[model samples]
Target: MANPTGSSLLVIERLLRDRDGIWRQIIEERDLKQLTVQMLTSSALSLALYGAVLGASNGPLQAVSSFVKLPLLFLATLAICLPTLYLFNLVFGAKLSVLQALTLIMVTITVTAVLTLAFAPISLFFLITAQSYPFFKLLNVAILVLTALVGLRFLTAGMTALNDHQLKVASRPPALPPAVELPADKPAAAKENGAVLTAPAPVKRLSDIGGRPGELPPGERPASMTLLYIWILLFGFVGTQLAWTLRPFFGSPDKPFQLFRSIGGTFYADILQTIGRLIGG
Candidate 1:
């Protein structure tokens, strides 16, 4: 089999062992196709895993819908959160290019997908043994939530690492002192008097003069956990909405198979009802 490219396999491996290095590549890498391929591969994996889990209760039909809905839910959530993240990062002075931001988000998606895939066998076991729909739904939901938490943790760590790297780059020694210019009127031998002619001291920019120690340079800042939390919340909101929109992944065994359930209530409401059933039992 052909090896997967950097965006998929290589980046994921790097994320596991060298998060900072992978993030640096995300910022510096010029090829966007690698990132795209990574996202697509990860999405495909997520679809398969979700299908397997949903297959437990809904059978083959719902498993097929899992092929569609799971990817849609994740991609949609990424699309919804991308702009907010880019803008917030810009405002905070970490101006990421659109591609860089997208790549970072894709990394998070890939991480989540990998984690979900890792749990697929357990889900399949549950499918065979547990006949309870509410239990299946809750278990799958818990799995997704755990995966999402891990993915978001990676995202935040990556952002922090990249921001710190940027700060270091920004703080590098000021450009070589401007070349010294000599006046044409002065004789080249004027220095024969044993006087030393030296370049005038370089003028420091306002940023260099005013920046506090350990603080980011002007118009530059590091990411904050506050922004990361907001992003996580936004992702969850979008994910829940997308899941509600693309319903019936776990159709009742008694009910007929369907791709889209009639819109009746919010995802949270359904979860609450499921919890009620689980507890009442």
Candidate 2:
């Protein structure tokens, strides 16, 4: 939140720290529900953004039609967004209102537009205007990335600072320093072989998990759907990537093709096997 313009970067930094338990209280109670929502939202945003980047690579200028006057387009957008955002913020207090969020977004886009408009004069130094299109586009992306990165770094630093404070507080020594922790200088006994033999690592603080420690024992509610979804995503993502990488060489008899596919196939198989073993295959 230190820099609103780099919202993605800031959010990412928070997510990283949250993964490290910074905002676990705000999220863990719902059993990672917030984390799932955030992941989905971030994925949606990234898909939209990268899609735009891919589209702009071909011809950004030609992509816009005659009726789509850039300046008027921006004006109309801001005019619609700012009012909506402000009203929503006033009413529900959620940040997503276009007036609230989009005002800054519009301004950012306008800056890019102004930079583009100004680039024409700079283009005179070069003969081929068409060839310079990529350069101009690259410049815009660079500007956006720099601003986003700065905001993100600030947010990340903030999250880290808060997390350290929480961890320290949660871990402070009790007045007597709990003789129970020493447990006769040895672990409690274990009845079953292959079971973890020691006392559990202080079960990650209750406040950190947004509930009392041991609040929900095994027989309580099931874990979460997000864990399953994450696994599914990784399974498909890794499988597809592997298939794509080896496709050309999969059936080839040429010098390195077979060797390459064999090695790649072995790598993937080993990965899947390791995963299976870890999950009690």
Candidate 3:
């Protein structure tokens, strides 16, 4: 097994080039420490990249806030969504272990952070050439949206790959070995008494309902789709709300440096208002 702690770059490389392999490693090894390390490293670098761009317009203090905000957005969103995701996976028969689930989410965040970092140079270019606050804010918003979509592609693909792997494993026939008989003395006493204790009932699973392992019932397909849609919505909602809570990454031209703006409007409303002011003024 590769040492996940010794090198974060190797993990990132595997994530980009061999996602299925990384997922298998995480599942087989039952390790998340490397994933956690990667998340922290990627998030920190993303903060620095974002701060570099924001510092061009917002000054040192606002740049510092940029450093703080992305981490807040990532961690807060994860904290808010983790429980719901775990429950949905449990109910929908995903068969993910706790470590597997945590690593999957960590991979998503790390990928997003890396993608954001990749866009930093472009953001800096706009910061230098475009002085309008709306332009800067909108541009970064667009960059984040693109990065998020790419990152989410990994999440969906990873889920599908895991499901496929599960099906392959489940479809294989179990090997049957010769059975051993119970000792004659115990059986004889039980037969004379005319009493036999029933065997313990097997625990039921969501996947066991009218289907083999890794195969869902016909009705369950729609429920799984619904859960996926809800999961996507929950991710977006939490991220947007957390971003709002950690406001001022672009820093307003009129206002002085402050860590947060008063929470009053929806994120979408604010974006529209910024766009209108940029165009009208």
| Better-scoring candidate (lDDT), 1 or 3 | 1
Candidate 3, residue 166: lDDT: 67
Best by lDDT: 1
Across residues 1-281, which tens digit of lDDT does each residue of candidate 3 receive?
A: 85644466555666887776776766565456766676667666775677557645778788877777767778888888988888888787667766676777777877887778888888888877877778888888998888888878777776666666666665555555454344555542243357553333445654566676556444433125467668978899888977887787778767788888898888988989889998998
Question: What is the overall TM-score of model 3 with all chains considered together?
Answer: 0.80
Q: Whole-model lDDT for model 3 versus the true structure?
A: 0.72
Give the poorly placed runs of model 1, Cα more than 4 Å off.
1-11, 30-32, 176-198, 205-209
> Which residue window of length 10 is worst by lDDT in model 3?
216-225
Pairs clashing in candidate 2? 85-99, 85-100
TM-score for model 2? 0.27
Q: How many steric clashes between backbone atoms does each model show?
A: 0, 2, 0
Ranking by TM-score: 1, 3, 2
lDDT of 1 at 148: 84
Model 2 lDDT per residue over 1-281, tens place: 34322343244444434433423333223323333334334433432343233223333432232113323333444444445334433453222223213323332333334333334333323313444433433343344345434433433343344335444444553244223333465557544456545554453444565655434322232222233234324433443354334332112112221212333554446445545654562
Worst 10 residues of 1 by lDDT: 1-10
